[model samples]
Target: MNLAMKISDHDVLLVIDVQNDFCTGGALAVPGGEKVVPAVNRIAQKFANVVLTQDWHPEDHVSFAPNHPGKQPFQTIELDYGIQVLWPTHCVKGTAGAEFHRDLDIARANLVVRKGFRRGIDSYSALFENDKRTPTGLLGYLRERELKTVFVTGLALDFCVRFSAEDARKAGFEVAVIEDACRGIDLGGTVAATHQSFRDLGISVVGLEAFL
Candidate 1:
């Protein structure tokens, strides 16, 4: 992609879930996830308005399978909030695996939104924790600062990245997800299914070139 284009101040760059837990050999590694580093870094450098989102959970966070008495990882359990899928313990607070991937150029970021810190709920979107408008303060900050659009790029295209983009759209911002700068766990099935889900909601999944 050409770097000649300029990114306006109203346009923000959303770095979604690039923590070590979602990268190679971590708690929830996505195949070839590490390969996205270069692309993410390059795209990040081109944007002046960048915000990063991290999955920060506790050791006993409800999302972890170990917290459930009889449930195991990858098992599905129903909660009052609806169906919650059990995930392996990952991105626990202050753990090495919870840190952002080493390859990312975080120094270029402006704000880092840490989510999923509550023991009873898990957060996949920067707009809210568990989709309930329990403020992550991201939307409010962006709105206060007058940021109108955000381009998302990071790990787990089907999960965190997807949810972030969807939430961005819901927050009344123009949303775009950089496909090549993301990697997915595919726990929800085919890549097409995930891409369709984003497209269904009007989120355009494209290369970083769009922003460039």
Candidate 2:
């Protein structure tokens, strides 16, 4: 379907984890990660409602590969919530790498939500932690502001952005993911599968042109 939709106050541009660590020269850099900032900045200017999310993890967070002996980044382990991917220490709380990319236009965002602070849990979605039930209060914030439709963008499309979009859709909000504004880790050839899953879930995976 063509998504030539116009922007409104009720439609939010949700920028997810476009942080220093996800960009070039950082520990967990995604391919073409830096390119997302300019696209997001341009897209954000056209929206009255905008929110940004950060992956703010603790030093000993369960998601970090260093936390588990003999584990390497991208290695999978069985946790209580099922499979969890161990990652190189990236977005630790209060660290420079945890901050948003310097070139990103954060001023356009009305609200910023930080997640993954819990030492025992890893959070990827802005709306919920990895468990899929732990609330990050993003849904309530949008509800209070009377915003419903969410256009998602930003770092690591297969992980954070994808999970956030899915959660927003499950929460009953109209959701679309801006493809050009996103970069994915694409671990284990998951990029194509991720887009398929997005379609299966009824989430519109569109380009920046949709809003133009």
Candidate 3:
């Protein structure tokens, strides 16, 4: 690992949804999600400013099947919140699946951002919830601490990490995504296309070791 790079205390290292919900044996497991743990841990050890995001949702969250009528998991539904993607019932508040992955070193974390608590909206991104409407106070927290550059890495690069990186860019922060420290759910070529989209948006997509 590259311990030679100059890192500031203000540079925030954001770990998004590194929970069991997107890990192996979870209801909403992202393919290859478990693989990022070690890389993420190495990054955590190298960064002093570490923030972890959690998907803390209620059982009847509108994004879940039990709340949406005639909608099943993986289905798309248009609601007042905008394009909502229904997901499996996972990450219920205080549930074991909502906890951070066992392979992750949670001890190194400094801040915790808990999102997706509202029943009416689904929050795939740690920065903004559905439709870019709900601010998860992540920007404010980062701004208060004078953190302008954010390196985000977590489960499902095609979704959560992608969306979060976009919002981070929109929020006027420099964003970098450690591609190796993330997994994607694309059985098709969408993951590759999404990577290009991120490139188009000027989001730095690099391997975890690139920071070293």
Candidate 4:
């Protein structure tokens, strides 16, 4: 839909967590996760402003299942912020899994915002950590640059991409998720739920063709 939609200078493409850990043959790969790379690369060329978000966690990060006794990846646990899905130990800082996917083309990205770096908090949204109170400086950065809209794409449609798009909309930016340029973890029907949430929040779910 909206094939005529055009990217403007005031819009920024926010690429989320296309890191090694979320790709094929990695620590916490989303199914068919690496498939999004081509779509992302193709659409990214259409944008003048781009921001890339990385999940940079520590070995002892609270979100990792290994950090919590008797916990497994994808298990839910209550944290100080709220319920967080325990994830496999992934994206450890300075590890290969923490690096961007080798096939990703980041030539157009002007900013790379790393999140979930704090050992105690898990950050899913690019604008804020899991607590929803701590700022990641992304909102102010976007505001200062006068970027009024955000087009999101990347790994795990049900988690990081979903949170980032929702937060962007909540922060008063026009937000859209490039559906074809994303893959979902789809844990416990989360993909369907995420689409519903996007609709409720007025976040557009658009195809990559919108940018093409």
Candidate 5:
């Protein structure tokens, strides 16, 4: 809503899993997922610090539906942290689906943090794996850089983007989600729930105009 907000070096942009597997025609594609690329790329040019997180998983990663035998994608199962939705076999390490979207601008990124690589765990938050305490080292990197605020964007707003925003806020950084620069899978009103959760958590859900 703050159209005139000035972006500074302390305000870092976190691009969450804008990879081939989440884009248009991907194995786990979110509807309109590819639409966020241009806005994210455009916003990236304005940030002094840009960090990109990729959903890099191994072939037998625990989140995969194939590993669960009878389960299917989007089916909820209990994990140690809580219930986790089983996902399709995608973003396997060294696979084309694991790669960032072809049109995404990665040149401006200061750091590229790869997550969900460990075979036993699934990582939705860029800062922390699903275990919650296990860090991906992003917090330390941001702290070392003296960054204070995080502007988040990229694929599947209800999942990775939501988790990243919540974790960023919990890590003591002011957080904002660039709404227009994100798309959601939106299973069962998840997008609306995410918006309400963001409001409850005091995370700003702003339009692209907030930066432009």
Candidate 6:
């Protein structure tokens, strides 16, 4: 695990969904989510290009458990795209939960991509919505900016961070995940499964020291 990679201008640091809802004392908190803030802040300083992602869902978003009768949070239901995990009502637009974590330093970020805002669709990846067809415009933004590699970090490693890394690879960009700068929901062995997926996708899982 000798990651002696240099931080170049062609690389971008993608901080994904480090919002209040995913942190402590919010609607849908991931364990130790707030702990990522410091790690992300420190690593972000090494990158010249930074992009932040936010999960800004509508109140009646399809992924919410309350939107589906008799379904509970963490339950899975089939949608037009595929299986959708129901979440607690969280990160509603214009709400405090949708805002970035208070301790997350975003001053260096040049772009902020907001996803999951559509009432009928859910977006887990910064590059694409959950449907895998609907573009979030991030891929184009990166391409236009000539960013050849993407270093991802932030909340819920099993979901958003994992999906973002995969999509970034699928879109032909080199991708890596800063493991220590992320937290996970870890529903039913998802953390282990995500690691397997990352291996299969050729996504590097490095620690904060990779940048330090």
Clashes of 2: 0
* Candidate 2 segments exceeding 4 Å error: none
Number of the top candidate by lDDT?
6
**Cα error, candidate 5, residue 45 (Å):** 1.0
User: Cα lDDT of model 6 overall?
Assistant: 0.93
Model 3: per-residue Cα lDDT over 86-194, one tens digit each: 8889899999999999889989888898999998888888888876877999888888989878888897788888888889888888788888898898745758987
Q: Per-residue lDDT tens digits of candidate 5, residues 1-212?
A: 37666998789999999999998888899898889999999999899899999998999999999999899898989988888889999999899999999999999998999999999889999999998989999999999989999999998899999999999998899999999999998999999999999999999988887777
Clashing pairs in 4: none
TM-score, one value per model: 0.93, 0.97, 0.92, 0.97, 0.97, 0.98
> What Cα-based lDDT does every candidate model obtain?
0.84, 0.90, 0.84, 0.92, 0.92, 0.93
Per-residue lDDT of 62-118 in model 4, one digit per residue for the tens? Answer: 999998998888899987778989999999999999999988998789999999999
* Whole-structure CA lDDT of model 2: 0.90
lDDT of 5 at 21: 91
Residue pairs with colliding backbones in model 1 are none
Off by over 4 Å in 5: none
Which order, best to worst by lDDT?
A: 6, 5, 4, 2, 3, 1
TM match of model 3 to true structure: 0.92
RMSD of 4: 1.0
Error of 5 at 74 (Å): 1.0
